[model samples]
Structure formats: structure tokens, C-alpha cells
Target: MTVISIPGSKSVTARALFLAAAANGSSTLLRPLSSDDSEGFAAGLTGLGYEVVREPDRWYLTGRPCGPAAGEADIYCRDGATTARFLPALAAAGHGSYRFDASAQMRRRPLAPLTEALRTLGVDLRHEDAEGHHPLRIEAAGIKGGELTLDAGESSQYLTALLMLGPLTREGLRITVTDLVSAPYIEITLAMMRSFGVEVTRGGPGNTVFTVPPGGYRATTYAIEPDASTASYFFAAAALTGSEVTVPGLGQGALQGDLRFVDVLRRMGAEVHTTADATTVRSTGGLTGITVNMRDISDTMPTLAGIAPFASGPVRIEDVGNTRVKECDRLEACARNLRRMGITVATGPDWIEITPGTPRPTEVETHGDHRIVMSFAVTALRTPGITYDDPGCVRKTFPGFHEAFAGFAEILDRRGPATRP
Candidate 1:
């Protein structure tokens, strides 16, 4: 078995930065991801006058329960949705005039759901350019949180931002979510908030209402887990190449919902086993196609789509319409790239179906999306000459992805087909 060490979870690192920044004292994060998204989140905190010290494997953040120390500041959120969404909520709970902007790509993504909810809570937020988009300003006089309704259908980061803001408010917050997607990501936020010493209550019909009490947060030493989304590429590679890949630090007790991508692989004839501290995937000498609903784990949809052409039947991924609004239209990007490689593919508003066939060598148009680059790398295992138009776009999450995957591919080439015990 080839054991691969992946980077820390970008989602976890972003949330921990927010929690640590709001806690009562300094917090230490062990093994935090040092990627563009995570670095952008930390940089935003620093711009807001929160102290952050970075080292090789750990990060130190000094909490400011009262909000940012800077009376005024401008924060550039880069391309990180977490930084763009959560930092403004953090700033809104403070007394200051803050301006927030992002890259053109991020500026094009939707910010209405979160911004509208903040506005409903009496936040003085204004869009300097396009409505429901970035380049916005916030005149913060502190938030007095109360009951409100939110629709998180397009993105769950909207709800996550508010949930993380609950303790920083005056009277706490009661959010009744009308519709939600990526529900497991909300669970990650709640788990991390509890680790920072705040317990949020979830009780309503189908747990639709979230009640978070005031009192801010208490800092604690936290350890970030490996990114399950990043690991999906290697797992998919194993499924495609008849190799065994073992990723430590992710197992049955892992918090990320993306880890369930292995369940999808299992259904497609890969052998998947999870232990307390690790998970392993080994192909069973073949691939079988199946239809799956990937709404909760939509991040791995591209990884599945990348390997779909090698399956024995049609591979259909459904219920992931939100993917259209990500860094790019991921559903269409996957279909386009697969078709570029001489594979048959069909797409609708929320689904894509791929017919099994041998893929021809072709350059993948990455659309500057990291998932697209990494997912297609799995396809490159069988179909060589698979270059990416913008391979460096992976810096947003995993800067060392190319080197890591190249090494894993070398190991698979030497080991040949994996044997079952």
C-alpha cells in the first residue's frame, strides 16, 4: 500500500481562524493548511488587527472577543469564499469601517444570501459595485443578534458565517434555515465552535433552527485534520489504476463529509476500508458505473467524473446544481474536459452522465479551478499527455499538489496491481 500524506483541511483551517480570532485568549492551530485560501483568511484577520504568527507546522492567533482592533481597514479576500464571507461577519460584530473586496472570479460568485441576512439584522452593509457581489463596505457598530430566516440553497457558507458570528453578537442568534445544501459543512462549523468552547443548539423540524448563545468563545489548542476533498484525487487514482492507496489521519471518525467519496468508489467496485486513524482504497481489478446524488459531497463530483470514462457502464452524478456557481461551472467544466478527451458525456442543469470508453490524450482546460486540475490528473494515469491550462490554480487549496500526486503516481507505476489478502 502507498501511504500518502495530504495537507490540512482548508475548510477546517478557515473556520479555526475565525473561531480563534473570536475566542477569549490566544489559540494555537497545529498542522494548519498553508494554502492561498487559508493564508488569505489569516491575512484578513491580520488586516483587521488580529495578531497571527505563522511557523512551519503550527499557527498562533490572538483572540479579540470584542472584534477587530483596527478602527478602519481594507481586506482583500483573494479567491477564498470562506475568507470573503466569514471575515465580513466578523468585522460587522466590531466597531469600525471596513471595506472588503476579492478577485474578479470571487467577485462574480454570489454573496446575496449572506449579505441579505446580515442586512436584515441591521448591519450597515453596502455594495460599492454590483449588487449581491463583492467590493462592499461595512460600517460596524456591533451586532445585536436575534431571530432570522436564511436560505442556504446556493451555498452553505452563508449559514456557516452566521453561525460562527453567533457568540460574537450581543443577544446571540437564532437562525431558521429555510433551505440548505452541503449540510455536513455546517456540522464541521458546529464541531469546531464547540471545540472553541461554544455549544450551539440545533432543534426544529428536521433540525432547521440553530440557536447559538452569546458569551463569545474560549480559546483552545486545536489540531486540523487532513483535507478529505484533496484526498479524493488519490483515492480516485487508486480506483482507476488498480493500486492501493492509504491516507492516514482520515478514518471513520473524520469530521469531513467529503470522506464519503470512498463510499461512492466502493459502489463502483473499489475496496474501501476505514480504521480509527486511516482509510484505504484498492481497486478490485475493474470499475462499475452507478448513479449517485452528490449534493452533500459535491466537492468530489469532479473527481468521480474524472474517472468515469473507465467504468463499465454509465456514470451519472446528480443533485449538484450548486457546482455551477463555484470557481467555475464545475459540472459543465467536467463534461467539457471529458468530451475534449474524446469521451462521450452529457450534462443537464444539475447532473452529468458519462459513457465508458478509452479516453484520448488531451490538454484539460482547468478554468483556473483547483478541483478541475486535480480531478483530471486522475484521468492522466491511463491517458498520458494530459496537461492543464492553469495547473498552478491548485495553490488556492494545495500548493504542493503536483509534486505530491507525481510521487504517488510513481509509486503506483512500480507496484502494479494490488493484491487482496
Candidate 2:
């Protein structure tokens, strides 16, 4: 069996940086992701005068529980949504003038929900450009947080930002969320908060209310898990090529919701085995397709779409409308790229359906979305001559994705179908 080592979780690394910067003592992060997004976040922290020392395998951050040391700063968030949404809230908890901006792609994504919630909590936040978009300036006089209502149907990062900002507030915070998507990501945030020595309680109907107590975070050493979303491409490649691929560091105790993408592979007629610390996928036989709701794990929708044409039946992905506001409209991007491959595809407001067919090699228009490039790379495994418009975009999450994936493909190809046991 071929085993691949994926990079550290981008989501976990970003959240850890935020927590480490806001904690009481210094924090050491092990195996933190080193990519454009994580690097951008660390740089943003430094821009705000937070001390961050980067080593090859560990990152050390000195917390200023009071907030950023810089009195005034300009932070460019790059394409990281977490950086754009969470950093502003982190800055608001301090006393300063901080202006945040991002790449054209991230600037197109909405920041209104989080910014509005911060404003509701008495933060003087203003959008320098279009209202609800980035290029925001926060006149931070510190927050005396209280109760607020939020609608997080578009992006859960809004609620996550508010929740992380809770302990930094004088009175703490009680947030009542009206609508939420990607509920599992919130669970990760809560679990990570607990690890940082903060306990967040949930109550009200359907656990819609989150109560974050005052007395900010306590620093601790945290280890990041391998990225499950990135692993989805490998799992999909295994299913498509009838190979047995095992990925360590993502088993039962893993925190990422995207790990559920393995279940989708199982449903598609792949044999999957899970141990305490690793998960393996082997294509038992030919593939079969089914409909799946990806609301909580929608990031892997493109991975599923990439290999959908190889299945015997149509594959339908639903309840991922929030994907529209990501780095790009992922639903449309998936549908568009699949069509370019001469495969039949369709998309609605929040879903995409793929009909089985033999895919023709074509240049995939990545739309500068990392996921688009990675997902279609798996598709390229089965269909040669496939190329990408911007393969370097994978640097956003996995900087060495091409080399890693190509290595995995080479091993599998040399072994042939006999690689399956």
C-alpha cells in the first residue's frame, strides 16, 4: 500500500495562530502548516506587533492577552478568509487604528456578517470600499462585549471570529446564531478553544446560543492534524484508479469535518478501513455513484466532482451554497471545468450534478482557486494531457502539492493495478 503524508491543517493552524496571539503566555505550535495562508496570518500578526518566531517544525508566539502591541497598523490579508475575518476582530479587541485589506479574490468575499457583529459589540468598524466588503478600517478602543444575534448561513467564520473574540471582551459574549452552515467547523473552533483553556457553553433551542466567558485564553502547546480536505484528492484518486492508499494522522480522533469525505468514497463502492490513527481506502471493485449532502463538508465537493465521471451512475452534491462566496464560486467552477473536459455537468443555486462519461483531456481553468487545481489534478490522473492555468495556486494551502501528488501517482502507476491487495 502507498501511504502519503499530507500537510498540517490550514484551518487548525490559522485558529491556533489567533489563539496563540491572544493568550496569556507564549504558545508553541507543532507541525503548523507552512503555506501562503498560514504565512500570511503569521505576517499579519507580526504587522500588529505580535511576536512570532518560526522554526522548521514549530512556531512560537508570545501572547499579549491585552491585544496587539502596535498602536496603528496596516494588514494585507492576502486570500485567506480566516485572516481577513478573524484578524479584524483580533485587532478590535486592542486599542489602535488597524486597516485590513486583501487580494481582489478575498475582497470579493463578504465580511459584512462578522464586521456587523463586531460593530454591534460597539466596535468602530468601517468598510473603506463597498459596504460589507474588505478594505476595512477598525478604530479599536477595545470591546465591552455583550449579547448579539448573527446570521452565519453564508460563512461560519463570522461566528468563529466572534466566538474567539469572546474572552478578550470585558463582559464576555452570548451569541445567538439564526442560520448556520458548516456546523462541524464550529465544533472544531469550540474544541480548540477548550484546548487553549477556555470553555464555551452552548444552549438555547438546538444549541443556537454560544456563551463565551471572560478571562482570555491560556497558552499551551498544540499539534495540528494533517489536512483532511487536501487528503480528499488522494482518496478520490485511489477510488478512481483502483489503488489502495493509506493516510496516517486522520483517524477517529481527527477534528476536521472534511474527513467525512471518506464516507462519500465508501458510498461510491470503495472499501475503507479506519484505525485509531490512520485511514485507508481501497477500490474493492468498480465505482458506483450516489447523492450526498455536503453542507458541513462542502470543501471537498470539487474532489467528488473531479472523479464523478468515473463512477457508473450520476453523482449529485447538495446544500453547499456557501461555496459560492469562497475563493471563487466553487459550484460553478466545478461545473464549468467538468464541462470543458467533455463531461456532462449541471449546477443549481447550491448543488452540482455529474453524469458518468469518459472524460476528455483539457486545460482546466483554475479561477485561481487552490481547490480547483487540486481537485482537477486528481481528474488528470485518469486522463493524461490535462493541464492547469495556474497550478501554483496550491501554495495557498499545500505549497508542494504537485510534487507530492506526482510522487504518489508515479508509485501507483509503476505498480499498476497490482498495487491493490
Q: Rate the local accuracy (lDDT) of all candidates.
A: 0.94, 0.93
What are the models' TM-scores? 0.98, 0.98
TM-score of 1: 0.98
lDDT for model 1: 0.94
Model 2: residue 378 alpha-carbon error in angstroms: 0.7
Best by lDDT: 1
Candidate 2's residue-wise lDDT over 262-296, tens digit each?
99999988999989999999985377889999999
Clashing pairs in 2: none
Candidate 2 RMSD to the real structure = 1.5
lDDT of candidate 1 over 1-421, digit per residue (tens): 8899999999999999999999999899999999999999999999999999999999999999999999999999999999999999999999999999999999999999999999998999999999999999999999999999999999999999999999999999999999999999999999999999999999999999999999999999999999999999999998888888899999888999999999999999999999999999998557888999999999999999999988889999999999999999999999998998889999999999999988998889988999999999988888879998899999999999999998988887787643322
RMSD of each: 1.7, 1.5
lDDT of 1 at 270: 91
